[model samples]
Target: MAGYTVIDFETTGLSPRYGDRIVEIGVVKVSHEGEVYDAWSTLVNPQRDVGASRIHGITAKDVLTAPTFDDVAPALLDAVAGRIVAAHNASFDMRFLAAELERVGYVVGERTPPSVCTMRWSGAFLPGSSRRLRDCCASAGIEIVGEHSALADAFATAQLLASYLDRCGGRPMWGDEISAARAFRWPAPRPAAHTLTYKVRADRQPERADGWLDRIVARMPRSADSRVDSYLAVLEMAMLDGYLSLHEQDQLVEAAQSSVLSRPQVLALHAEYLHAMAAVALEDGILTADERSELDRAAACLGLAQHDVDDALAGAAGDDGADGLVISGISLTVGDRVTFTGEMRMERSVWEARARAVGLQPAGLARSTKLLVAADPDSLSGKASKARSYGVPIVDEAAFAKLMDRLEASAD
Candidate 1:
């Protein structure tokens, strides 16, 4: 009848399958006698844009020096190794945890402990309507300290679990549920630790990349975070000669390890640099053999998959210059707000440049943009989801081009 480990996670979004990731974790272990054994929490630097910041209130600045998921994976594994993991929405947090563990090469189901979803049992305990965390806590009269913070949520969930057990007056059906959760087997466990401390950089300037990539990363206002800076520094070196040298590889690995970037973050960054390359590869016309060769090495250094590389190249097919077929009828004026999602035919830089050329304005993903140009209107990406939720109009690449062309013509 030992108490279970109640857990909670603050993630970038709801689904891990859509490349959403966990940004924070909190856990509270309650003893069988209803006494609290331990509590732990940490902010995970996802090494990318912490999406839906408005909802979670976790600003990028908060995770500036936070450890990456892999760095904290061992500790998380240690915490949940033998305990039963419980959460308000256990499946949601469990899915994210499982995805992260598998990403790091763990065999989730076999090595993982069981889990409990407090949400399912809400009907048995909480009175009235909603199964939402806040509602359930309210029904039980349990106080929720911080609405979305992982630590606060986990602690509250732990309190709720105690209430559930107290209601049953006996050891609840914990064993079967544990086994059922184990059926979702997560990946392997690494090391275990109670906490991790990060050292602030003594050098204010930090290390800078002197290559052409400096301009690129510099212009990207979003890549200003510490881990991203390090990631870009390695890419800067790699792009200098189109091949990451042995020395550069060492630096890259060191930076990556130091950043504690989760496996997905690393993959995302790799996609980023490749996207940067693709955005401009065909700007001067066709990709020369030398350019193509350099890109191949860059892809290897970035650890990008062949399919990703091919996808980058596929965008080049749309670069047919003035001879390209122009899908017309769309119109736009100067100062119109525009944004983009999906893998577009044009790179972000080129898209922005084109927008400026026509006296139009380009917007960031989450900005109050009027239009969202998407490669596929049906994408499940966070941007597309948000756009759909906000009732933003989504246009295809052809429509986007036609709009831009119309604007250009009007200006002339």
Candidate 2:
């Protein structure tokens, strides 16, 4: 075997075609003469949010300043260039690898060095045992220190590849699988494939969205102005990393029902939510990979039948500013879900009491929440960050108190 590169990817989900992406990658290269080169591994800024943080232990803070895929692609190309590519599940890694590479204007072919999965080959030599990475590693007595960490998994996989080489010798047993793997290449991009959206088949138009359940949901505590806030909170988190799990989808549907929105209203809210998230993603000018992932997740969850998430992305990529949510220009009212953040002229308790005295109904930090009263509009508190993410504007406490006084006078 010529010098080879063993790779591993920690991703947001299972499929790149469906918007799942690599948040991190590790590549270890071994020379043709069995000498290992320096290992290459790094956290990537997915630009939206990291997915499955528990499994990978990568947080938004961890990748906040990490290099983007385009920034590191040249170095990655050097690692994989002219080397046999190996992975525990080579297809998974290659799928992400190929997708990431193509997105940055480099289309890779399989013939140059070829790709192979150790899991496929392991079944031939080690029967009766499962082919999971750790299982195969365990069969070979190869301990995986950090099972899902891109670097550790890549290292462990490197050892497993060496073991497979020893057991199978020069004439490996799995010829057909190996050959198929060697020939696999991502298909060339279709004309304007990147721009064309495979529009999601809008669901069967429901006969009636305003049923008894709708009434009950509508009767639920939505803002006096609109129920949009309730949905956006759930939607923003759902698409933060570009892919929504089935569990999240169910939760969103249930939450939508509780909001008393009919099926049509639910769909309409989904569109608005998509635009808001898009605006957030585009706040940084160039939409980062994580942001793209989120747009894809939103499109999928919102029942958009677009094949190309880039379309959703394109719609949101305008100069929307990075000031968080921008509800400043819209008409808002007193009972339309309001809350307070930051230190204010009066104590929070006092402010709340006074506001309530004037018949101003207060709500929590929710999506449909109309206004936020802050001591400092520029406070970087967690609550402020959330308000920005949900596109709610922050009006300082002094402003709020003045408004409350005006309301009291008007009432009298």
Among the numbered candidates, top lDDT falls to 1
Per-residue lDDT over 272-329 for candidate 2, one digit per residue giving the tens place of the 0 to 100 score: 4455556555555667675566566557767875554555456556434222122312
User: In candidate 1, what are the lDDT values of residues 332-376, reduced to their tens digit?
Assistant: 677778887777777878998888887767887654676788786
Worst 10 residues of 1 by lDDT: 321-330
lDDT of 2 at 115: 71
Per-candidate TM vs. native? 0.46, 0.43
lDDT of 1 at 380: 55
CA RMSD of all predictions: 18.2, 23.5
Steric overlap count per candidate:
11, 19
- Per-residue lDDT, model 1, residue 280, is 60
Question: Model 1 compared with the native: what TM-score?
Answer: 0.46
Local distance difference test scores for all models: 0.63, 0.59
